[model samples]
Target: MEVMDLGILSLVPAVIAIVLSFVTRNTVVSLALACLTGTLIAGQGLLGFPTLLKTSLGSTSFAWVMLLNTFIGIIVAFFQKTGAIQGFSQYIQDKKLSRKAVQLVAWFLGMFVYFSDSFSPLFVGTTMRSISDKAKVSREKLSYIADSGAAPVSVLVPITGWAAYLSSLAIGVGVIATQEDAMNLFIKAIPFNFYAVFTIIFVGLIAGGVIKDFGPMKKAEERAIKEGKVLRDGAEPLIGKELTEMEPYPGIKPRVFLNFLLPVMMIVVIAMGTYLTIKSAKTMEAFLFVLIFMGISMFVQGIPFKVIMNTLTDGVKGAVPAIIILALAYSINSLSKTMGTANYIISVSEGLLTPQLLPAIIFIISAIMAFSTGSSWGTFAICMPIALPLAFNLTGGDVTTLVVASFAAVAGGGVFGDHCSPLSDTTILASTGAAADHIDHVKTQIPYALICGGVALVGYLVLGFMSI
Candidate 1:
């Protein structure tokens, strides 16, 4: 396939993709459709879609991410089925903390389960829902806390699947030639991920009573305190009784350490240990090790072999949506490359971008893309390839402070948008876990998320000039 400049027209595929995602609220379909549109625009006709899929999805990076997420899903299912998460929740209940303390505890728990953004919110929301209700904490508040801790914390942690996928995307772009360099760049950009950092801190402040609630959240909090109603009157929670009320297998006792904590510890130790000794982090290997350990431990604890297999299959099934989105994302990325979309943008904007404006602008654009599409990983797939290369071009192909700031802008912006978007999986999961109304969760979270986003924008503006 020959790469075509397409001039300004090269932006058509991504633009159509983003617009279609917002209008249809279906990222997978939007991406696929956009790919077809791209093929037509590129003069490749209908056959280009298959060629694009083959070239994009048939890669080592995609395989690694797909497998990593599959293993992660299995672990999540195992944790749910074995009642380790419930056991931890029970342990927290035993502490008999105050309302503020319970909120803070939920926040901490969310950050502790930092490996998967998808897992953290569901675990924290479910774990804290009953406890928070007992303490007169609103479901809105609980959902906010759960949602805030998820993607914000996961992206900051380097030993997780987010890091693996993100760093993999950076490989062969600009100065990020190897996995180690890409991972290193990711780490170096951490401090500059202002939106995520600020959002997490803001949540802690609100949870700990250091900050007062405002907007719809304030009203919900007031209602919870005065009327002793955890949910708004007539509110319909997104989740049902069947989903919220999960139990361990018959006659099996839930052990938090064996089923949950130990496996998480293993991932951390293995990932970080490999990164320290061998430069590149063996993130996928760490997950694989933990997956095996989890299965063996569950089997030892009297779980039937058939049940274990069933849980594994369910895990794979749960992972399908994400896998499909990633596959489409890769295809679009390939399409964008073939069209030279980023190159066109760079060529068009070269004279307009200033050091003081670039990072802030990137942050705003990335935020809009993520919020509209409501998929942070999808946002990453589209934005990173464009953003990183632009950064490299502006910084003369070196991984300088300017380049790092630009990278952080994209990452932080995506998280900020994810936090605010009602269509986001983490946000919806937060509502389900807290048993809160889905729309109510979205309504209450926006004000808080915007405040953090606003502050982050300013931070980016300052850092951009300083870096340059």
Candidate 2:
């Protein structure tokens, strides 16, 4: 198929899937259909049926990405089954921290985690939800903190997942001599990432109570409080009674709390230790070190081996949808590259837009792509090739501004779309994590994202006109 033909066909599946998801409220089904469509479009007689399956499953980046995510899920399950997360929540509650304080801590921790890993959203979010709830902070607010911190902080940090991806792309395009040089360039561009900086500030403002929830969020919070209902993680309501009427899990015995706390502390200590000791090691290496620590912690906690296996299995099962989505995203990306759909889009847009307007345009385009695809990293990977090349052309090879703008657009748009799209895995996870109604979370988060995105757009426009 021609580039335009492939691009047009791509739209069909996404549109159908989105419409079906909205109508049926079944994201898993919708995403599955979209994946199938994307795979078929990619194969397009280039390979036999068996080979197509093998190609999709064996794609290097996709496979490793899934493996990493699966590991994260296993860790999360371990945290949950061992009562570590709940114990941490209890510890925070016992401290009698104010709601505002807890929220601030959540934001801070999220920012901290983003420096080390893109999985900050899940790790920081799941760990902090119980604490935030104990303080009566709304789940919507918690989601905001997690989402704001994830991509924004990652892009700002030179050694994070965002930088790694962009560096690899730059090297592939021969724009940089090596991944190291590419990373250095990204590091220098950090100050120019206006969207990320402003978004973080916006999160702080919201958490500090300077910005109150408006629109659907305000309504939902009001409704939740007035009805006294418990919101579950993934945003579904338990319904039929006041939240207090719901049975609480058995109170954490001191021993159980100690078992949980000791292991978690060990993980943190070892992760930090590895980071400090390694000096020049990759983030993944540090993650592996922490994983080792986690293993030791598990042993120290005396959590049964069978229980650990079950928790790991449960975690992997939970990640299945995300894994599938990521695989499809990768396939679609490869298809677009081969078909030149990305280049076509870039060519069409480049003529109509200028360097001064590129950031804003890229931001908007990234958001649309992310919303359509329901994957932030996929959106980043897709747009980076087109946006970076355009940025370079516009600036006559001024690498810094172009790279900064491209990175900002990818991070900002990815978060914006992920924040509001009901089809997004993070959106679903946020709803599940908060125990709020899924639709309610989507409805509530949209206004917040719009307001922040508007601010970010203006920031980008102003910055785009300024020199480094």
Candidate 3:
């Protein structure tokens, strides 16, 4: 069914949803309500919400997300069950690294496993958690490192899933004439991806102890350094207790080099190899390949098949909340598209924004929208169609720096929410991977994210006027 033209009121659903997300601090509920509101508005009555949701769930993209994230959960569980995480940490510990060195290593490992953002937190967080704890590092800090390592690192690198998908969005906006043009623009936008680049630098500063902790993070850091507590007292970790508490099978020694290194190498190699050759990285396929390889390796090591199956089930169980969140995220994005949220926002701002302020305005709007929705990809889906065209027109068709700045704004702004929002996939995974309390992870991470956002905000404002 076609949507009713609500004119300016098309903004109401998203506004309410964004308000609810802040007031309730419940991501799934906020997004669902938002989707329902938009769907109802689109239908001009109460009956259409269900149909909109049903369609969203049945969509191919939603199914792909479910499978992709489900596989990631299974990978996390399999590694934990097979004791690959523990073995990797043990290997690190045996080197007798200091706390600083351990954090630096974790920071680097996050970037090292940069093939898939979906896989990075589980791989880096699970593997590094033990080592970070041993080094007296706070779980909150570890979660930050893992998230920063995954999304920000992946965003800047063209070979990863983030770049490939976003490059397509650039093409969809009709600014770039072809996929090749979009890819070239993506390359040019890299340095202007200020938030992502600054975020990576901030993580290094934290890991290297150049940036002192403040906010909730400082308290968490103090507890870790002064009291030797990795997680705060009575905090509930997002990852299942089963996975975190699981042990290696009896009398089967885990090998860091064989089990950990080999499987990780396979995931990276296949992800990059396929992307370079085929243009699509196919992250889920890479994960499945490593998962099967992990299973065979475990079987060779004498792990019981039943135990492995159970471990995989536990992995899926752990990811259920995240999966629900992802579904709701897609639903809202689709509904908002139907409701004309992006067009309304653009229409309202059309006369008010000057080209001198376009980049800054786009950056802030994209960041806020992404943060409220808890999906950077969805934010890109919404904002790119409007923002890209605006920048293209404002600068007389991509001839100047404004076009690149706009692309960077959308990309960086999208990642800004991924870093700050509790509902973001990377943020959630970072908490899960580090075994940190979900809310605690968000509270501790947001301050640092704000720091990066602030810097990027200023940079965009400068770039905006420079375009004039």
Candidate 4:
């Protein structure tokens, strides 16, 4: 069957997905329905389930990502099971640091966990939440700090899993001469990533007391300060109360923090180590290693092998929802691209695409896709193909600066959406990591994210004209 462009129908899947997610608050059901809608459109039939799953999960290119992400979830559960996560914050609490120092440490750890954005929240948010709570910091504040640290820092850092994936994509577009060239261009584009840079700086400023938290964040902070309520009275945390509040298993070793830090350090070391050697990433490797270590550690601590397996399963369970969401996120992106969603948007914006406005336009559109879809990687996948080619052609394939700006726009815009969208995995993980109410985290964070997003918009406009 010949598939029609469907004009605006190309966008229906994403819209339906987002609306369902918001209304139902169940990402799995929402994404599944969205995928079905798009698959039906793309295949022009009701029997596209296999095609949909293949596009989302069975694609060799994305299979690793889904696995890598799910393993991170397992590792988070491991931390919970081993009592490592608790020990991390407990170790920090031992420092008796000031409130600002604690926030600063949390912010820095987000940067430190630069290898994987998924792991960043699980490690930093989970580790720092208790310390922040002890310091009278709201869970909203904790999630914001974690969310900001996770994607923003990973996107900027060249050694991260994010960079490797993006670099491979950039090279595949045929614009760059080689993967090395793509890597260099990605590094050069970092300074122009306004949303990421500004978001990071904004968090630091808040941590340093240079800027006050306003909007919902302020109220949450005040509630924490005065009422000693880290969470709103009726808020529901994403990770269950039993897990977040669990104690070390019976006869556990002296250094619970070691259990946390060792596996975390290995994730970084292994990812960077292999990335340097083979140019293949190690997110999955690290997660598997952590899982094995946790199981053994727990078993050694007198827990039966069966119970240890249960703990491992529990960690994977935390990540399962996220992985399912990720698969659908991919499916929607494929459907949108196949349907020409980005091209449709670009086609409409043709009248507005001056050289001076290209960066800003790309940034805005990228942000829209990411926010709507709740996946920065998906936004990059959708928009980069369209944006890069446009940048290449619009500039006669000669201007390096314009290309860099466009690259920055895509990356920055994706982060902007990921930052604000309640549906984003990074945000959801942030809520779980901090043990905050998911919607509350979204509510309190939107205001601050938008503040930085506004700054990024104006900056892109200025840079666009400067490149001209």
Please tell me which predicted candidate would have the highest TM-score against the true structure: 3
**Model 2 lDDT per residue over 68-168, tens place:** 66666666665666566666777778888886788788888877666543456666666787677656666666666776677667767765456666667
Off by over 4 Å in 4: 1-4, 16-66, 172-175, 320-339, 392-396
Candidate 2: segments with Cα more than 4 A from true spot: 1-4, 36-54, 116-118, 171-181, 232-304, 314-344, 394-407, 410-440, 465-468
lDDT of each: 0.79, 0.61, 0.79, 0.78
Better of 1 and 4 by TM-score: 4
Question: Best to worst by TM-score, what's the order?
Answer: 3, 4, 2, 1
Pairs clashing in candidate 3? Answer: none
Q: Model 4: per-residue lDDT, tens digit, 211-306?
A: 988999999999999999999997767775445655556666546656777777777888788888887767677678877776777677777888
Cand. 2 Cα-lDDT: 0.61
- For candidate 4, the 10 contiguous residues with the lowest summed lDDT are 240-249
Report lDDT (Cα) of residue 266, candidate 4: 78
lDDT of 4 at 103: 90
lDDT of 1 at 371: 62
* Model 1 root mean square deviation, Cα atoms: 5.7
Residue 398 of candidate 1: its Cα lDDT? 89
Of 2 and 4, the candidate ahead on lDDT is: 4
State the lDDT of candidate 1 residue by residue for 382-404, as single tens digits.
77898888888888898888888
Steric clash count of candidate 1: 0
Query: How well does each candidate superpose onto the true structure, as a TM-score?
Result: 0.70, 0.77, 0.89, 0.87
